[model samples]
Target chain A: MDLLPFFQQLEATTVGRVVRESLWMFPVIECVHLLALALLGGAVLLVDLRLLGFGLVNQPVDLLARKADPWLLAAWMVIIATGIPMFLSEATKCYYSPPFFYKIGLLVIASVYTFTYRRRVTRELAYGRAPLTACASLALWFGVGFAGRWIAFY
Target chain B: MNFSAFVQWLDATPGSVALRESMLGYPMIETMHVLTLCLFLGMIALVDLRLLGLGFQSIPVSEVAGRLLPIGLAGFVLMAVSGALLFYSGPIRAYGNIFFRIKMALIMLTGINALVFHYTIYKRVASWDRDPIPPLRARLAGLCSLVLWSAVVVCGRMQAYNWFEKAPGA
Candidate 1:
């Protein structure tokens, strides 16, 4: 589709103007983005490993999940918050980049898994092992991270 | 060789040359570096929070640490390898960076803190494993590690930009 005008319009906005004009703003936001990703991914993988029966097997699943879940949600919020301004600054470039779409797609899939399959599967300890859900979570989240880095290259 | 000489050597090494030259080499290694942090930092957080009596209190501290150590170490190994490749690919910028030095220092200090915890206070873990609140030393180590690791993350991220790039022989 010829949606280039929409992205160009976004780049003309005040928020986009600030991000593009200020040399330090982009890298500052990027640093925060990476830090938030570290926290979010770390929390997600820790819980997923337990779900896969790899680590923390003998521990109560819900208890550990409870501890990590807060950090995960908070960091997710930060990632989006920081990511938006960066995307807006270079809206046209990101819109045309294949890796940006790939990253967004994986992020959506991973978020769905987190809210649905993961939540249900890890809800009760008596559900035995659900390696499939755990595996999917790992793959989806890691895929999002990988694609995010690829945005810089491709 | 001096520091610059060592860095020059790393930059010229065959593997480093390939990583720097190949289009996908740097990004791929960076992807692995970020991915591995999930295991290294994520696994440690679970056990550290337990030691601090903030998480997984229902489980014994030793068990939490015991189960998570292997996986965390595996992540650390992968992280170190990938991190080395990243550094080797662009040693000039990396070596002159202040944040890089801070990250290295934090890594060394955090490692020593872990070693001390393991050999000493952790030896008496049996007595306090289920205490809900671990011994003062164990909790101190946990807190220190968490803070240090977080700082390292920020430093590593900051080093991505050239904010601290110095002048030539100034």
Candidate 2:
């Protein structure tokens, strides 16, 4: 189904108007969004490194991943909160952007991988290894970031 | 001998020419630069926040720093390589960019702040390594790192926008 109508309605809201009309506000939100993206990407990669048999080896892989999980999740929350207003402000532009869709797709795949197979494998490191999963996780999340950045290029 | 001459030489370099002319090379390098930056910030925030008494209190600051350092260093190394490539791709424009100048200045300030911390209170960190609230200087160092890096990220991000423009010379 077409989503432009929903985007249009959201953009008509007071918050959306402020986000769209105020030059500084959009940039401010953008700054927050970008920082959150970086934090999230970093946190995720740190955990991924553990899965790849590197980084944070002083502690158990599970512990490292668990400890870093909160920051990863917190940054994700901030990104989503800040992102919505920016998206609402330029809903149509984003809706038409290919890279935006790529970002979303990669985000979904990365999150799923994080919550499922990646978590299981890291939890049970004795049962063989999942270096391929680690590699894919890195590519997927970083891909989301790259695609998100690409949205601005267009 | 002069900065302009150096920039001119860089612009004429073969690798730089390919970076600018290739369809995917510049974008791919830019992507890596940004992603590495994100990873670096993430690792920095973990240690800095603990020092600032904000987050991750369960673990000792030293342990947190120890664990994240290698990954952070890797990110920094990769970013340096990608960043040099980016600047080399368009030496004149990068040198002329106001935001690029701010970014460099902030990076220098951050380096100095870290150096001072390492040389001073951080050397005697054993006593307060596990303290929930760090000593005044340690807290100040952490606060400075956060603010300085925040500014650096903003300046770096803004470099791609309108504030950057090409000058006739470097």
Give the number of the best model, judged by lDDT.
1
Q: After superposing candidate 1, which stretches have Cα over 4 Å from the reference?
A: A60-63, A125-127, B166-170
* Per-candidate DockQ vs. reference: 0.62, 0.59
Structure candidate 1, residue pairs in collision? none
Span of 10 residues, lowest total lDDT, candidate 2 chain B: B161-170
- The Cα RMSD in angstroms, rounded to one decimal, for candidate 2 relative to the true structure is 3.6
**Candidate 1 chain B worst ten-residue window by lDDT:** B161-170
**Which residue pairs clash in candidate 2?**
none
Relative to the true structure, how large is the alpha-carbon lDDT of every model?
0.84, 0.81
Model 1 chain A poorest ten-residue lDDT run: A120-129
Per residue, candidate 2 scores C-alpha lDDT tens digits across B56-109 of 676787887877876777778998899988999999778878889989999999
**lDDT of candidate 1 over B1-170, digit per residue (tens):** 89899988887778877888888778888888987887888777767788888876778888889988888899899999999889988897788889999999999999999999999999988889899889899999999988888788878878887755765785
